[model samples]
Target: MYILLILAAITAINLGKAFGTEKSITGKSEYALAVDVRVSVPSSAFSCMKKYGYKTVFVRGYDPTGDGKFDSNAVDNIHNANKAGLGTEVFMTPQPRSDKKGSQQLVELYEGLKNGDIKVKTIWVQVTSPVNWFPDTKINIDFLNDILSAAAHYEVKIGLYTNGYDWSQITNNAAADKIMLW
Candidate 1:
């Protein structure tokens, strides 16, 4: 009877292993991590991101200072994300200037020798600030159009992120295929 019980226990263990439940026995779980970074990843978060098997990351590309200076956000995150073996994407936000000059600045930033050269998996343009401050559909649309043009000039595809209400009224649903919900 004891021999039979031992054999049953062994079989159950083997079955669990075969079914891939062994990780639970060791308190480990499979993780596929993806994250977004607004400014910086704090450097320390890189290890955490790697621990979770981070494969993709969205890092703010530039702060778009009208003074022709891009923030170190993209540069900082790009290095850390690369060290952590994470794929990097760029999110470019306009500065206080949300008009033609803003788009021109966006293009210049993304096309910068340092900023433009980074390997961005995709470019995501934030629509909130533009809509909130600009308020006029034409202004925002022109902003987007210029952004789209600049992105095209760089040969990068753009992904738009925004909440699905008033901002949507500006971005519109016809662009559903390109919208990414956060």
Candidate 2:
């Protein structure tokens, strides 16, 4: 009877291992490591990243140049990352002094993503550069709100990428509670 019980326990353990439940039993985290890149990289790089256990990559999607346009390599990088079996996300650096409004910039980004047939859950807005924002907190707040509204208009989410000091300087930490921080 004791031999039969031992055999049954061993079988259960093997079954769990086969079903990939050993990690849960071992208390191993299922979360993935992520990296953000501003420039375009080749597929081989992404493959290397995956082999090294990077599960997600955030690629820059917007170019804050004259009039502000989508980054030329954003779509291709996203596709490459996906093909390499890594989860992909996009971030945009907005130019406050550009001719385009915040909403217009977001429109360009959204349309670009749509045209590329790329889907992203959220577009993280980088607000780290102090020179990119106005000195008046109210204007900065309005600019962020415009982007937020644009995100909502397209049924997409928005996240902020800023440190505490930059956040305080930019919008006085306004709307901090409304969006996810990265």
RMSD of each: 15.0, 13.9
- Locate the minimum summed-lDDT window of 10 residues in model 2: 1-10
Relative to the true structure, candidate 2 reaches a TM of 0.80
Colliding residue pairs in candidate 1: none
lDDT of 2 at 102: 92
What TM-score would each prediction reach against the true structure?
A: 0.65, 0.80
| Residue 133 local lDDT, model 1 | 40
Highest lDDT, which number?
2
**Stretches of model 1 off by over 4 angstroms after superposition:** 1-32, 42-44, 64-69, 96-100, 113-117, 129-131, 169-182
Residue 105 C-alpha lDDT in model 1: 62
Give the least accurate 10-residue stretch of model 1, judged by summed lDDT: 1-10
Q: Which candidate comes out best when scored by TM-score? A: 2
lDDT of 1 by residue, 86-122 (tens): 7666766665343446567666556552543565446
Q: Scored by Cα lDDT, where does model 1 land?
A: 0.58
